[model samples]
Target: MCGRFIDANLRGSDSELSHIKIDPFERRFNIKPTEDVLILAKQSLEPMIARWWLIPSWHKGGLKDFKLTTFNARIEDAREKPTFRAAWHHGRCLIPAGGYYEWTGERSQKQPHFISSAGNEETLWFAGLASRWQELLTCTILTRSANETVNDVHTRMPVILNAEERDAWLGGSDDLTMGAGALLRHHPVRPFGISDHGPDLIEPED
Candidate 1:
């Protein structure tokens, strides 16, 4: 499951659909779970902005009752899971991100890595599903078994969508399985310099 992510830019503007832009944050070298991140979704046939974590409206008591982790949804079980089934069918969405964070290490010492497109692509949109839990809406990223490049870092990776599939994902298409399988990209991990929030942690670019 992907709990932490980084989106240095926050899109907010008058343009209805073209407002997607990154804001200047001190470069989130390390992003933790529950932190507000940016997501791109379609509303009334136009793109809109949403936060990363799906906070259902039913969770009125505050963040506790929503015991379910609304971060990652297993590709294999999402269609049948109560929390995700409806969204998979009618409430699809997209998460626009610069990169994501993964950890690999022993229980005591965990090391985090940033994963993004190889080139200087401005953003990467992830295949996602969302739902409106009462008045509050929530969302989750879909994850499949790791590909060869990501196997060493973790057993799973978020299902990333290509440019073509972005529309289908947010269009409420019924063929979710096929649509999701078509947009995945798995890149090998190279040595890249990444800094931690507290101390300076950098690695050689691979």
Candidate 2:
């Protein structure tokens, strides 16, 4: 599952880009779950903002109230899951980041690695879905079975969306399957580091 990530090179000032604003936090190398990160979604024709983790409206209580495992939704089962189906159809979103983290192996022997664009684009947007669980709002990143590139690192990767598909993903249309394969590009072993300002953290290379 995608529990951590990086969003270092955001172009908040770029008018062509969507809802992202200039974040005060310095580029992060280790972004954990429940932490507020930038998401690009739409409210009508205009882009809007949303937090990373998704909280279902049926949930009761605060941050301490729910389990932390809802951060990601499997692409194959998301449409059938109660927590994600509504958002999958009506509240689709885009999570903007430099890269994401994944892990491999048992607790003591787990490894970390990072994945990013081949060209090092300013930002990468993962397809996401969001919902408003009472007063609290939340989101979940979509994950697919690993491709050739990601197979070496982990068994799954987030559903990444390219610039052209960004508009459709955030448009909240019934066609949730559009651009599923075309928009995504994958990289298995790219440059990574332990520092906070460089690449995203995945399981350590074993």
Candidate 3:
């Protein structure tokens, strides 16, 4: 699961959602669940804030009901999962992220790896699902089986969306879902994950 990620854009100036003006955000190298984040929905290019964890509208419980993990919805099961089906079909969204973190090795020897776009882009847009609960907007990132490059580190990775695929994903058409599958493949730029942190965190480590 994508439990941690980096929100490198502290200034809204570098935002991909430039169509709509956004306020500056706190830069976070290690973002956790339930944090408020900015997102772009299919309904509009405007930027909106949403809690990272999704709470389905049908849920009867209060915030305490958030115990069920709804942060990462597996792409394969999203359509079938009751918790995600509604949002999957009607609440599709784009989540901006610098990169995400994953761990490798046995529990005692586990090491952290940072995954980002293969290109020099500052932010990676993720395919996401969002829903409204008690006037609050919440979302979850979608994940698929890992591509070859990141398969060694973990068997799963978030579905990273590219420019061309963005419109199709936000299009909300069933046929586009089929096309979106092709984009699910690993990025072409050789390296997938780096093992260290620092200014070069997004770069592949030797």
Tell me, by TM-score, which candidate is best.
3
Best by lDDT: 3
lDDT of each: 0.60, 0.65, 0.73
- TM-score, candidate 2, is 0.75
lDDT of 2 at 57: 73
TM-score versus the correct structure, for each prediction: 0.71, 0.75, 0.81
Q: What tens-digit string does per-residue lDDT give for candidate 2 at 1-206? A: 68778764665554345464455567777776677766655644334445667887777777677775788888788888888878888777777777766656577656556666554355667888878777656788888776666677777778776665676667654444543453223333333444444432333433
How many steric clashes between backbone atoms does each model show?
Answer: 7, 14, 0
After superposition on all C-alphas, the RMSD of every candidate to the true structure, in Å, is 5.2, 4.4, 4.9
Displacement of the residue 64 alpha carbon in candidate 1, Å: 1.5
Candidate 1: segments with Cα more than 4 A from true spot: 8-27, 43-51, 55-62, 174-206
lDDT of 2: 0.65
Say which prediction, candidate 1 or candidate 2, comes out ahead on lDDT.
Answer: 2
Question: Model 3 scores what on Cα lDDT?
Answer: 0.73
Q: Tell me the tens digit of each residue's lDDT in model 1 across 72-190.
A: 88878887876677777777777766667677778666666766655334465677776666655567788877765566788888877665567666666545443233322333333
